[model samples]
Target: MSDGVRLNKRVAEDVPCSRSEAEAYILGGWVSVDGVVVEEPGARVGHDRRIALLPGATAMPIAPVTIVVHKPAGVEVSAALIDPAQQEGKQRFLKHHLHKLELVAPLEKSASGLVVFTQDYRVLRKFREDAPEQEIIVEVAGTISEGGLQQLNQGMKVSWQNETRLRFATKIATPGLIDRLCRDVGLRVLAQKRIRIGRLPMSSLPPARWRYLTPVERF
Candidate 1:
């Protein structure tokens, strides 16, 4: 029943931050209109109204939490695992653990690797395809061609043979075929960690521990 645009939308249009960042600010209680904190990003406000971040709020808008979970096979990313009915129309998945943080993203159940959980959606936004800083590193263990890795590293133009696979530093990878690559390379895939989202390397932190993203960590 509201007539104004959403706070995230307004922030995206006016500030350098993405819509996700604006939402994060609202969720973290950093967003204020004329000085009053507003919890709802959908709240209506004038297009010309002034919005500000609480002093020092940007130091770390999200609480200190980041989990590196080794998702077991066969679990769906929905909100419900056993019975979808219990979730009231929400699908069940591993993301359920971070429900308290209000983060939303579908995880691939069949894949077992690194799963990151955080209240910080802005950090997540960096993984979007359009984000300039985004880069994905998935280990491929297969009998790749002599130049296969090199081809991927060069990012050859997508063709029928390549299909959706994109070239990484020295390998071709798609979002869904890591398992096959592992089989081909004879690697058992003991584990696959999502090592990087944008320039943030997973190696920087210990597994299963959550930490507040430093200002330098913000892409």
Candidate 2:
């Protein structure tokens, strides 16, 4: 076996930084050996191997992630539903992204739609404090008469957007409130799919896949 130096020691010497800074850079995913990024500070490296540090890489705390998931009916929302392969966002999948995650905008297991999982406490707080005031848009399949539609709109807004479906918008809805409201107004519920929450739209996100809530996106 060839005797190789510790990667952090080599990095500290080559980068001309302190041992601790070198380790920090390594841990921050800034350093690569032979063009392959190696995060472990204690990894052994040969003297002849080329090492490069990516430009603008920093040693800093990893930012918490907020993920928007489109849950399918009857499926549970959990970290098990988050697969690195299914990530459609620009952020690289890190195992830490799944840690300390809290669910927000919870829906019944029987209702499918936009749900959120966040590691940031600020996001959690916003969803919790603003839920009662947040508007939810759901696509529902039902048949109703003009009188029934008018009755449905007495407390909640129901729109016959098309001949094929009905759109329901409400700010005072709980998990099963919409269904209960529809039944109360002589409407038969065929299916329900939540399409939007607050100002966030499900957009093109399909069931079970997720993407990062970008810094620019709110709610």
Candidate 3:
């Protein structure tokens, strides 16, 4: 009997990689069970299949489940256990009740909008590594006492202490200027949501709901 339990799940369990990484392996034809390539992460297999992790592959999830939440302000996007009351207190902030699932990324308490969750580690890794330029839409309700907005228009330097995706922002006086706006607004960002990741936009998905990212959408 082949010992395999869905390519992605097996990969997630065996290695430190995420589910999305396994999917990439499978899709790239990198995963093999008993020397035969398997493309489906949900495909059932024995507990002891001689599974091999090949380089660069993609595995297809049954539903390709991915979630996009319009995270409101106040709650934290972390895996650490917290009080139920705390979670409940931020109910309005949550796009959905996500206490059951593990948060793959850390969303700050002050930041809000477009938090993703999934069992797919590969996807997580891709986001972590590629850090593809994304479009973040933030709406500032209050006015800035200082010339933060002016300095932003002139361009400001921003950095993260930890090694993460590189990002820059600029002001958007244009209607379609997502990147420019983030760069130009240095005042206290009142509200924000990642409207688009790569080419995928969160405008269609319901708030606090999950959707499977199709293979094409993985990039």
Please give each candidate's TM-score: 0.36, 0.69, 0.40
Instruction: Estimate the TM-score for candidate 2.
Output: 0.69
Name every residue pair that clashes in candidate 2: none
Q: Candidate 1: list runs displaced more than 4 Å.
A: 1-114, 118-121, 132-142, 154-175, 180-190
Give all candidates' CA lDDT scores: 0.47, 0.77, 0.50
Q: Candidate 3, 87: how far from true, in Å?
A: 19
Model 2 regions lying over 4 Å from their true place: 1-57, 132-147
Give the per-residue lDDT of model 1 (tens digit) for 47-112: 767888777655244454433333344554432232212222122122223455433223356443
lDDT of 2 by residue, 46-144 (tens): 999888898987767778889988888888767777887777878866655777888877777777788788999888888667663334444555566
lDDT of 2 at 36: 90
Higher-lDDT candidate among 2 and 3? 2
lDDT of 3 at 70: 52
Candidate 3: misplaced stretches above 4 Å? Answer: 1-66, 78-105, 141-186
